[model samples]
Target: MSKGRLLDGVSPIEGISPTDSLDTLFLKSGSSTAHSPQSLRAKPWPARPQQLCKGIRGWRWWDSALDVVVVMLPIPFFVLAAAVIFVNGKIVDQEQFTILNHSIKGATTLFPICFAAITGRAAIKFATWKLEQGTTIGVLEQLMGSRTVASALTTQVQLRSFNVIGLLMIFVWSLSPLGAQSILHILYTPVLPTSTASSVAYMNSRQQSYSDPRPSSSFPGQWFNSLAIEMGSMLIAPTEVKISSMDINGNVKIPCQSSLLASGTPDSEGWVQTALMNATSNGSLVWSSLFGIPIELGTKLGNTTFSIESTYIELSCNNKTVESLEPDGQNGPRINFTYVSVAGPYFSAEDPDPLDPWIIGYRGVDITTYNDTDGSAYVFPLFCPDCLSSNFANKTIEAGTIAFQEFEGLDNANATTVFCNPYQRYVESEVSCMKTAATQQCQVTAQRDSVLPHMPPEITYLSFPLVALGLSALLPNVTPIHDATNEVQNYLVYDPLDPLTIMGEDNSVLTSGGSTPKFLSDVALSDIETRLGQILNAFVYGSTWNASIFLLGESIDNLQGHEFGGKNASFVPATRADIVAMIQNQTAAFTVPAVLRTQAQVYVCNFAWLGVFLFSTVVMLIGAITGVVFSRKTIVPDYLGYVSSLAKESPWIRMPDVGVNMDGMDKARLVKEVKVRLGDVSYVYGGYSEIGRLAFARLEETTKVKKGKLYV
Candidate 1:
């Protein structure tokens, strides 16, 4: 073959025979100054045919497009992920959130590898193109073609001079980790509390009817008898049992508002009496017309909070020994009870024509007997009258003249006379109700101290009847004077001052017969006051039963219509249907606005981290596009940085040179059968050999190095 130029501006080494093989020339010029590794010159060979130079170029416009598409593939995935997080700020389902997160994570991991492949290929093309332009294999050139992040970083630091391509290569490789972390951290699911607007049904007492009219002569015979029987059952039931029953039947808890009476006083009972008196005088009592309405039930909200208006009666009393007494011999030795039988201020003012006998007043006698002997015994009678009122304000009452003229036993008598003033109050309160996990609870948060305006007439009318029923059912009856039978016969009466009589004996208070009994002198004043307060509480608590019964509207007609003789009979009590119709005719179903809160897993997007990811993505896309544009004209196989590619045309190993301009894939297919290895490939001169150099060469020419052997 004739000697010719293998590269531009290069010739074979001087005095070298043109007929010698290229390897012989390489070994011969190893010691020469012009052909050293640091300043190597391309070897001469036979000139290539013009047709070979015109063979198909490795890269095409379509190849560049493919590279750009690979780099841009992950962008849509990122956008989709961001949109999902932004659209649904909260994710309630765990599986969907996890699946979305995993998809993003997989994309995040895949993008960097794809980016490196495309850019790394472009980098190899750029380096080869520079060599084709006759540029030397310098540090910047080597760094621009580096594929790994560590090498890229090292190359970046070693760059003492500014080169746009080198800096861009470093920048591109740096984004791998940054973009990955950004994508990984961009979305996270956190458990957070969220609320939605909801509504709940609540008892709206303000909307109930406040009117019930009956003639004075028909008061005891009409609705009063049924109310008394119902009150009787209520009085017999324990307070705790009543409360528990309310909870079970209503699906709601009605907490008592006894705290309204908790004014730090030695005698809370006496304090209540005084307060009630003051309230009645000043007309400051708070009243609710529909006092016994049940709260609406069955709300299916997750966790709700709302406020409602409610009312309950509170009772207080004062019990003390009478310091002075005057007697009148009407029938027998007894104390007479007296009070004006008129509805309170609220009722009288609001009623168009107030019923005359709606309010109850006592005009009866209580007799006491000591030692069962006429001369030696002392009489100390106590009487408690039904002083029911429609008014929630303060009021006072006084006892009538006692029939006993004198005390027979004087200072030595063991019995003592006692007086009691029981006070009832109408409490308007703001109750807060919360329903969580299908259970509802209510508590009285505040009470109205001053009277509210526009008291419902139904509340006033029902208040008198309720108080009267409570008093009669729970308290011992007082004996009235009979004109025909002037003889006053006392029956066994349970003393209200005795706790044992109230709590220990089931039949003591509920079944006790006629006249109010005398309080024993041995009973403490505190015990007397406590027992009176308890009786009053039992009276007020009857409203809870009324509420429950009213909730059982129309059903009671079936249960009690025949029991009351007949529904339409004049002697029959007002039916549950009548009361329900009277109250609910004009009212809308009560409801209140509430906030329903529930815990959910929320997809929170960290835009700052997302911005970093997008920044890296945009930079990488620009870099990839730039690479494609800059390497469009390259005309060499993708042979950079590959040991197999390096083995071709190596001085120690001979191979055909026809594939230099072919694509790497085509070249790889052609050389798939060629075997190569990293081994000893030392040059021998004048029968002397130096340290072996490790290089990839043909299997026939190379010797596999031992495991422990070292080579240059």
Candidate 2:
């Protein structure tokens, strides 16, 4: 190889072309001297790069300033909006609202990150300048030096798409409705003071009740017995009784006073005693004989026993009113009484009638069989008539029967005294009886130490009519009285397992395999029954006459009156208007205003416009970041080719085959040769390689330089 032609068939260009020397040729012809290479070297590069649009003033500064303005436009507006929201307390701590607010705030930081990404092109430019020792941009500037500015202009136009996209993203981030709505909400739709109101949940059908006083152990037990004393006297000398009275509306008033004598007769005790004797008899002959034999053997313990109780029930009127004597006809009533006792198969402390009035209370009676008996007979089981009869007992009483006698002055007075009216003034007595076949062996005698003087006891009956009266009084003209009774019920359920289950002590369990059973034993059931019976008895037997008089006619609306102790049965001292007023006040206690009725209330933190503004601002920032990361071009490393060492040793000029045609060269062979010669030579300066810049720059340089040769 020749020193000047180290590569075969390659040589350097001889000299510069006359056309490129036109500027110097003209200058030398005019000034009589040509510029030396030293003078050219000393001159500065042109202020603007050689490009198609270099003469176009204001492009670079205008473009850059517009981009910066758009990116920064939303900053102040965003700050103002956030400050208003925070200061006005519209920035809620609630997660639902704050999620949107956080997104808006996050978008504010995206601007700087996205701007840095877009400016990666500047980093590329700086790195290329250090490597290539050039002031202008890489390939385009080199081409612009020799070609018309249009070629450089074309290359620059390629980047306009990315720039336009970035600008659009910035514009959206700054001027979107997010900020506008925030501003509008702060200005026009500010927060307002919230009002609180309430509503009512009516108890449509409810009840009120009162229980009675009773003995502690209302249920029958071995020692469950109560004693009550009744001993008082009263005299009413009114000439004539007031049988009934009514208010202005014709509603009856109770407790009319009367003065008429109905005293206990000499035979009253004897009659009561006879009834008690009959009631106490057991129908079994063996039992009767056994009882009589024991009493006869022991010598008549005593004639009989007597227990008498009396009390004066008083009723005085606030306003003095006329009083009257009881009539001497069927209309006038006298004292009445009854007695009952039960004998189970065996002597067990269990009441047959749990609701019986005498179970937990005292009723006056002249008991003929007061003495305890030791029968020598074998008592057959009760509730078995056949067994007793077969055993010569003749008859059996399943449950004990009652014997009663009611005597009124009118019935046996020969047209001289009052009548028998169980509902009004009457005298009554009773004793339990049993009949058996014993030839009257068992005998009993009874006597009364004293008797009652009955002259129609003073009675004060009260009729509440609470439900209908309340409704009719409040809505006198509108709402009609309804039988709201069935709509509601006073339900009390005994849940034995509730407490156990709540405490997690319940034995019952359901598992994947099976269920475990837990139940109350018989003893538990019996104990429960006993307790329940006691409670019920207290509620029943301990109740007072006054309570019944006031509560019995709760829903009644009619004004007609019934007799009670020669007076109205259902009545109240207060007028109907007053009763109605009481009901109104009671109903008012359960009501409240309509607006303040929610279990929990949640108030809006601020206006709706502010939320909209926040959401829109977040969307714009995301868009800008998306464009920066995915759309804009940043630098990378690759190259078209490298200079061959053989070619660099000599001056060379040759054109490689373009893809359009390989000219006579084998395409694969040529490609291999180019790779072998150029693969080791990289565009990147040590440890720094930008594949995108090098590849693009090398292609442009190769096309312009043509076989890697210089013209001058």
lDDT of each: 0.41, 0.24
Model 2 TM-score, 2 decimals: 0.20
Lowest summed lDDT window (length 10), candidate 1:
484-493
Misplaced by over 4 Å in model 2 are: 1-333, 336-602, 605-611, 630-632, 636-712
Write the residue-wise lDDT of candidate 2 on 568-676 in tens digits: 2222223334323323222211121222111222323354665655555455444334323321221221111223212222111122212221111223333223322
Supply the TM-score for candidate 1.
Answer: 0.48
Residue range 1-712, candidate 1, lDDT tens digits = 2222222222222222336554564555343433223211133322352232312354456665676686676567557556665645664566776777677778787868866776676677667667666776664355453687777767656655447756766777888877877787777777777776665554323232211222333323443344344433333334342333132233232223343344323232232221333433442322221113344434453555544443333222233233322232543222212221123211111211111101122212111221233422112311111112224223322221111111112122221333443333333334445556666555333444324332321222123332333233222221122221100111112342232333333221122345332323445544434433433332333223223234333222233223221121111222334323322332222345555666766777888887888787776666566556655665554556655466554654444454445555555555566666677644322111334456565554457776665556
TM-score for each predicted model, relative to the true structure: 0.48, 0.20
Task: Please state the error at residue 451 of candidate 1 in Å.
Answer: 17
Q: How many backbone clashes does candidate 1 have?
A: 8
In model 2, the number of clashes is 45
